[model samples]
Target: MMNNFSLLLLSLVTVTGVSATWPSDWGFGGWGFGAWAGRLSPSQERQDEVHDVEILKAVVTSMAEWERSRRDTTRVKRADGSVCYSNVGCFMGSAPFSYLGVLPAPPAEVGTSFHFFSPREPHRARSLSFEEIVVPAADALQDAVVVGPEFVPLQQDQPQQQSVRGRRDNAASDDRSTTTTSSDVAKSTTPSSTISSSSSTEQVVPSSDGSISLTASSLDGSGLLEAALNLGFNASLPTKVIVHGFGSKCSLIWVHEMKSALMAVEDCNVICVDWEPGASLPNYVKAAANTRLVGKQVALLLRKLRTQYGLDPRNVHLIGFSLGAHVAGFAGAETPGLSRITGLDPAGPLFEAQEAEARLDASDAGFVDVIHSNGANLIMGGLGSRQPMGDVDFYPNGGAEQKGCSNLLLGAVSDISFLWSSSEDDLRSLCNHRRAYKFFTDSVSPRCPFPAFPCESYEQFLEGECFNCGSQRQCGNMGYYSDRSPARGPLYLITRDNEPFCAHQFFLRVENTPSPAEPLATHGRFEVILASKELNESFVLTDKDDEVMETGDSLYRLVVAHPLMEELTSAQLVYTAYSGWISSGLSSWTVDKISVTDAFGKSMSFCKKGMILSSGVPLLVPLFPGDCNPPRAPGGLDIAMGPSISINNELPSNASGEELSASNVNRTASPAPERPTENRNKTGIDINISLHLVTTAPTSV
Candidate 1:
């Protein structure tokens, strides 16, 4: 009876519109049988249902055949006109799979369950190492069968349903007894046979004309290649792979900012890897573990891209942060000879103590540069690694505590701040950890250059010993435009605490001449003011408590972090003595010589001609007499002593005898002529003479 019914149905389908030959475009959404058959069996409902089910089954079979055909087309013929399947191919399409460079996964038995907890919240999950979190996830990825959209957890689901907080408390104890077996670890390390044939989990993102969507149930090299081709990614141009850390996603503000910055700088392929499914937050242990697997997947995609498109690996640059930094390292290792790898404070925790194979190391790429913005001890809540992870590791502000993070944390704690807000205070807490990427983005084409002095430590850099980049000492540029030095080690530099952190750094030496009669009398704060056509800047020459400048000539090195980008003109040196038991408050000192050096190591000196300075007044000292055509002194005077300025024998004093006012001092410089075309420096450096005493009081030290 069934055979008779099937034959009748088949005959009806054949007579109606069913073609003997299938259509080439018969894919997942294509069902020409339905379109061709209009109103089939309107009088019989049961027959119609049976016919519909059978037709759907036929459509599924056709779709499978179409996939097979498409895959078969990837196999090209050899010189003999026979299809070839080699382990190593000019293109990886339909090539025989080999486990030449497959990544190792963590070990976990089937049916092992896992739970997660927030790092901020009190939880026993902390007691469980990273191995516990990632091993299970890796095992699931390598072995678990996906029946539908969702991943069937390899471990059995826990019977007791508890709140998030309760689960957090019991996570460690619940799974402590069931230790991972040795054989399970061995099996997990060696991926299952199914893994090599398995597809990756991914989503495609395009720049123009289409919304981002996941095309298939799995991610793999072929899908990635097709997506790149369809999205109009130019294989000839350099490709920048930006990978985000664990617990973060591709849509991060910094990631978008970097993409935009790179695009603005130059046209290139910017592929932002979004492994959110594997690296989801609050499950940080799981995310951390998945990094290796995701990295391997990325490597495979890159390998296919290179083989098929002839995209040079030398043009490939990997930029990753925290856990993603290690991901870049893994990819670089898997695909040898990558052009560059920039790690923005690679994650600490388990990675800190891991071997080179397990964590980011210097040998991953041709040129590996690292920025350590937050390397505070992990136990104290810091998130980045303290150990150097790249060939040239830049430590900004000692790479321990960042400039403003301390204050932000203090404010949050004092105010009982909201958990999530757009407040500046809230944003700054993450500022230090994320500043490495921010600095790099700005450096792509910054207005002001970020000049860094190479020193053994930041302390030495601050002390002014490492001011010169020449004379056997080297200098490194900070951020995206960094020029790696042959002499590699920890490079130190200081930056502003906020955005637009780049500043002009200058090292100046103040030569203080002692009073001939009372040499040991200078004991107070000394202020030096430098003026330019655009801005006025000052530095404290003498410390309030220091007595070193009392007996003889003292050489003080001052590091000026000038926020303004202007050429320096004239300077005024003032000294104020502290009121002591023996020393008078109105005592004076003599300025002999002043020398200044810039980032280029060019030194410029101005002889002060022994100008005596009183506590109540500022002593104006001329820098370049050649540029100072007609000095604008108290009486419109033009006095040039080769390279010196005359000093007033006596100065007017206020009631306190120590409060120096601009009115009390006779200070002036030659007013710059209106756009003197011929007199500008040949080098275009605006080092002209245009100084005037600022009436505003100097900030107290």
Candidate 2:
């Protein structure tokens, strides 16, 4: 049975994505035998039975346009010995809404590709880290069978079942107490497995019209999140972490922007969670209590991520604007899984409350570094209220309000808020996913250049080059001011007045009928400033080169997640075998590192760490070698890499899906489900996975 499943899966690997002519049925809706035949049964009935009430329909809708295009495809050779194909079919949401990465088993030979970006794999930075989170195809990618944490009592189906944290801290107590065991408790509440009873093992049977089907439980109630069909269907791994907003006038700007940034950097899988608005608090006391509760929920999600996905327990980052700041902070403080949180002007209203818990600070949560624009965040112990996972936190100009609502969904435009005020369309505070990303990953936008240096200090920092304002053509620095500095201090950016003055210039909202025919005036101002952590204790842990940065130093270091350098390009830095360097005095450090600061500078030590340098630019992501990054599954057969603006451009809408379809468009492989008669009283859990794979198929065309 396993072999059958593996063979069925192997048929889909168009490793040689040759662009030769294909068959007309390629990527079109088709079927297989056995469970496959049952798949087509009551297609409409399944639709009617599938109960989906997720209010975040826009998320689904956002993905729908792309989903509808997925289709099955097949390869065919012509009479002339060449090959060609065709696309057809439609795509529908598979089963299991949450984190599909672990579901609907695929053959071990295949896995889907997720796009992403990271401090370990930035787009154009100089320094890079070894951060690639990949779950093995099926076998290793087992869905977390969550029961419950010891702290909270889950409302299980069992009327009287209970779970409590045991007082015993000893290993013997942990093993014998049975208090931590969720299996018995969960079984008391719900049935063992949600899968159907008849399925022994998935066996793909061919059907007429050259299509396949499978028998599995799925999201729509029709099937489980089935792993694969021959349809050259495609999947994306969301590499970016998005803080999705849940309130009206509460835009998820940052989520979208971060998505774009991650896409620009590499193929990544995106995890979308709610950024709910705080319901109105009648009083300070109530508000404070509510804030605590909100924080708790955030904490729960963090743990879920850790248990559900192999999200680096340390690398999870949060970027929240407006009210999300509170939520991010609450989650960061409350959850053990979370490491970083970026509060873009966390609302000041909540801080007004008399409640102590409501007053968020670095210490409140485990996050080490803190950042704030205005004095909105409370400062305690010289640490910031706006804690981030790393030791370094940036406070761009505009105080706490600097780009307050950076949750701007628009990609490049999201970067604008940091350098300038936003337009009316985004006036209600948007999320700046790009800048937020830069906070932890040093993923600065090309538009918003880093402050450049010319005094033999830092150069080629991209954008904001050091220039002699004294020289006519050189003084147009976007973030720099007319002032030049030779001191070891903040790097200032100067903005100039506009020519045909933007009628809607920030600080001035001009209406129509302006009679002024006068010369276009300049209205530039200092936008952002970069300073060494040495300037302030919050930014402390600043060290010079050859300082022999040890374990206690902030784990922070500059990195270029991705390199544009086509060939070998190594930064001139020496990293001790036991530790990664904080800075390389050599001018050669050029992998896109904005800077690397530690969360506990001189406080914590790493057991074993090594240096990772970008050896190549690796422009075409998902299929390239990066700073110790494993390659991503390539796009489906016959497709080359393209910067598809529309999701369909990257993935297959049901129609485009047909372009990559196969005989098993609906065929599925059912992992061995523990039988009620056999394992009704099972002991340890048995795990299996169906991995949908995209291989090294080449585009023959």
Q: Which candidate should be chosen as best, given lDDT against the real structure? A: 1
Cα RMSD, each candidate: 22.5, 29.0
Query: What would the TM-score be for candidate 2 when compared with the true structure?
Result: 0.30
Q: Which candidate comes out best when scored by TM-score? A: 1
For each candidate, give its TM-score against the true structure: 0.58, 0.30
In model 1, residue pairs whose N, Cα or C atoms come closer than 3 Å (at least 3 residues apart or on different chains), thus clashing, are 111-154, 111-155, 111-156, 112-155, 200-219
lDDT of 2 at 280: 24
- Show model 1 residue runs off by greater than 4 Å: 1-229, 407-428, 483-487, 515-518, 542-566, 574-587, 616-618, 624-693, 697-701
Off by over 4 Å in 2: 1-239, 244-254, 275-299, 352-360, 363-371, 374-390, 398-443, 446-701
| Candidate 1 lDDT (Cα, 0 to 1) | 0.49
lDDT (10s digit) by residue, model 1, range 457-568: 7788778877656656656766665643453667877775544455566666766544447765446777777766676667776656334465446556535454453566
